[model samples]
Target: MRVALMITCFNDALFPDTGKAVLTVLRRLGVEVDFPAAQACCAQPMVNTGYLDEAVPVVRNFVRAFEGYDAIVAPSGSCAGSIRHQHGLVARRSGDAGLATAVARLAPRSYEFSEFLVDVLGVEDVGASFPHRVTFHPTCHSLRMLGVGDRPQRLLRKVHGLQLVDLPAAGECCGFGGTFAVKNADTSIAMGADKARRVLETGAEVLVAGDNSCLMHIGGILSRQRAGVRVMHLAEVLASHEGAA
Candidate 1:
């Protein structure tokens, strides 16, 4: 199937490698993937920050940019959740029937990385091999919004020689709620500090999460504290094989 890679704004800027890893993994799976040059943010930021009205143009651009793909796949659960859950709210809040209809048509076609791999592609192993003790952090959108529970772990477990470890306080929010970080800096830092501590306690060499946004937030604190742990996106780990890392 032809799939459009909806690279989120942050990933486009700070974590381009994650986007590349996602593309490489999908292409390795023999799936047709396209990167639409016109694509931008899914308007998740504006909608999350109580600026639903401001998100209309972004939502429109998203729909227009990805008009042709049979399915939309993003490396981020937050972006996928925005398209699947928040787009309609933004449209209706603005009283735009046409925009809502457009979102309705497009939303169902979008899938988070894990969801597309486990639910649509129907496979646990993407034929990747990464031999390291790694732990997973279930980002809020992936866990609470998308309910993509254990799908990521299932895929990780199938990787040859990969050792998956349980993260302490798994399933807790890392407090990188996009704009929520700025609006509530202290609270965000406190939550991130706690998450970083958990990552350290796990004794895993790598901390993996589906969303890089959360990793960025949690990783910054961990790095600042010199935690000595590496933060990686799931796609990156999933793309690594015997000699690929």
Candidate 2:
């Protein structure tokens, strides 16, 4: 199967390690993944920020870059959800039937990392070993947009020496809704504090979430409080092995 990695722009700029970790985990699974140099932002920022027209070229670039891949795997549920749910809207708004058709064809083929692992690859354990007490925060897009319920948790359960703790109100949004954090700074910080409190309540060494955007927001709060808690992307945790620096 031809699989491509749609490393979203946020990851590319801020959390390049997450993208590398995704490659690590997929390669370890014997999945020969392709990284299309032509790939760019999934246009979620424009669409979510009320700039659908500006998003057309980005969406166009997205479908073109990942057109022929049998599956496009994105490490982010936010970007994957944008591709699956929002791309069609942008296409239709452009009044381009061809674009709409292209989006419909490619969107369904796009899968979030956990969805690809648990649903497509059908493997819970990817031979990962992380001896850490970790608590997972289900990002909003992953939980609500993609309906990736328990799939991430199921995979976490199988990691060797990993203790998966239940985060209080795991479904609540961390207020890192992309631009939402920037536009509504006060409310965003309040919500992030609440989420950070929950993470601390778990008393876990690390806070894990599929989307690094959310992790960054909460991690900032944790760092300011000197919480001494590390934030890691889910892919980073999964890519971890028994012995490697």
Candidate 3:
């Protein structure tokens, strides 16, 4: 199957490792993963921040970039959610019938990492092995927007030597809704503090989530609090094997 990797804006600049890990894991599974050069943000930031008019070009660029690909995949649940759920709204709001149709055509073909791995590819164990006790925080987009129930956890469970611990309030939002963090600093920090406390209570070595933004928000609080826990992207853990130092 031909897969196009849509590296989200955050992942492209901050956490490129997640993108590489996604590529590695997919290639290991014999899937032909392609990186479309024209891909950029799914225009989620503009759309979510009430800048829908400014998001047209970005949406158009995204549609044109991977229009011919068999499937478009991203390592981020948030970006995938944006493409699947928001692109059409932006297009329709701008009164661009052509763009709306293009977005409609492209949205359903996009899949978040775990959704593509378990649902599209039909494989759980990518032969990954990681010797660590880890707890997962289900990002709101993955859980609610995409409704990816337990698919990520199921994949993690099959990893050799990896101990899966239950996270307290795993379904709670990490409070990093992009601009939401900036608009409501106290509320965002409060929510993040709660999530960080849950991570600490789990006593896991690391907190993993599909969305880096959420991980960064909660991880920052844990770091400042000296909580002795590290944050990781789901792809990084899923791509690990015994030989990969």
Best by lDDT: 2
What lDDT does each candidate get?
0.90, 0.94, 0.90
Encode model 2's per-residue lDDT on 1-245: one tens digit a residue: 99999999889999999999999999999999999999999999999989999999999999889999999999999999999999999999999999999999999999999999999999999989999999999999888899999999999999999999999999999988888888999999999999999999999999999998989999999999999999999999999985534
lDDT of 1 by residue, 97-155 (tens): 99888888889999999899889889888989888889999998988888999999999
Query: In candidate 3, what are the lDDT values of residues 9-100, reduced to their tens digit?
Result: 99999999999999989999988888889887789899888898899899999998999887998888889999999998898988989989
TM-score, each model?
0.96, 0.98, 0.97
For each of the candidates, give the backbone clash count: 0, 0, 0
Best by TM-score: 2
Is 2 or 3 the stronger prediction by lDDT? Answer: 2
Where does candidate 1 have its weakest 10-residue lDDT segment? 236-245
User: What lDDT score is found at residue 37 in candidate 2?
Assistant: 100
Between 1 and 2, whose lDDT is larger?
A: 2
Q: How much does candidate 3 score in TM-score? A: 0.97
Model 3 superposed RMSD (Cα): 1.4
